[model samples]
Target: MEKVIKSSDRVKDHGEVFTPKRIVNLMLDQPEIQSKINDLQATFFEPSAGEGAFLVELLKRKLKVAKNKSVSAKLFNTKSLLALSTLYGIELLEDNVEMLVMNMITTFNIEYSNIIQEKFGGKVNQHVFDSAKVIIQANMVQGNTLEKITSDGSPIIFSEWKPVSGNKVQRTEYTFESIINQSGPTGTVQGATEEMDLFADTDFFADLQKKEPRMKKYALCGWTSIYKQEIV
Candidate 1:
């Protein structure tokens, strides 16, 4: 039998309890939820993703859809990554977050290898694996979901990967809070103005101009190369 609780201390402190596989399947079996699982691009976010049990099952279903829609190795690679990109999660405990990432990566790689052997009859693509790693790492983050911030108090950021054309994707970053508030991306911006020199020969009025925060967008790149962040 699977161990659902790690320890009594964890249970008391964080209420950490893993859902049983049977229960997870039954819950996901509902008609409306199963319909979304069949969509290769439908995004799913688990606010309390302990060890990623739900996300893993979701990935498995999406991978099946990807396989059904693919007729070649290249098409399989593209669709499988697209499926991987749609699953996101947040785990409060660091240990659970580590396990969550591991489980997700393992499940995805195993499915990839299986498809390659059964359908493609060739070596699995390393680029595809690397890209999946990038997606999993970005989508699954260790944070307090209710607070919308990471353990260190910084805002949690998630990347949005949009397939633009062919195998190319456009990447955009959005803070968890911004996403919840429907505001916008909290992008990399220049630091606040340097300490006012009061005595330095400077254009006082020019120095007073507020530095607008610029939102940066990654240039469109092949889905297999998303690990490299190239700004536009």
Candidate 2:
């Protein structure tokens, strides 16, 4: 099953678009992220939560920690998972959002099932699954990060934090339009005023408040830098 899913043509074509699992694991394994997980106040956000790969892994790790610590069945209980809504994700594509929700539900089902079976000797509970499905559905949102608007005019807000370095986190907000235009068919015009103009808006600066409070706005064009020996 794993091989089939991993080898699917759609998976092969779109896999590169997803963050590599190894990289996700490494990032989550970082001491800073580990400490953040221990800090219940920390919220996780993935702006480009393609199919929710990172979210699933993070949940699994959290569940493992809860179990290992014997943190009471109530602490790791189904209700707790529902409240474990600290993780948030945004996907620009509606279809991808749907897929992400399904993936998250599946991940929850597997994790919950394991917990129930291990703790309660497989006394199945349909209510748990139903409740988890609802929670997962509610957590994933479909919207553009750049526009901060949904398919409808509703505002898009995510509670997740994109981890940066120690004691720092950034809210993941990519100006989808800006990214698309910058890399689009324009043929990479080194330093264009229009590109710079996009970064100068007050709205963009406001959005950066929680994520990149100190991030400096910069214009980008094609540039080459040579290192001492190896070209960079």
lDDT of every predicted structure (CA atoms): 0.85, 0.54
Give RMSD to native, each candidate.
6.0, 15.5
The CA root-mean-square deviation of candidate 2, after full C-alpha superposition on the true structure, stands at 15.5
- Would you estimate the TM-scores of all the predictions? 0.86, 0.56
Q: 130-152 in candidate 1: lDDT tens per residue? A: 98998999899999999776786
Highest lDDT model number = 1
* TM match of model 2 to true structure: 0.56
- List runs of model 1 lying over 4 Å from the truth: 186-216
Model 2, residue 89: what's the lDDT? 76
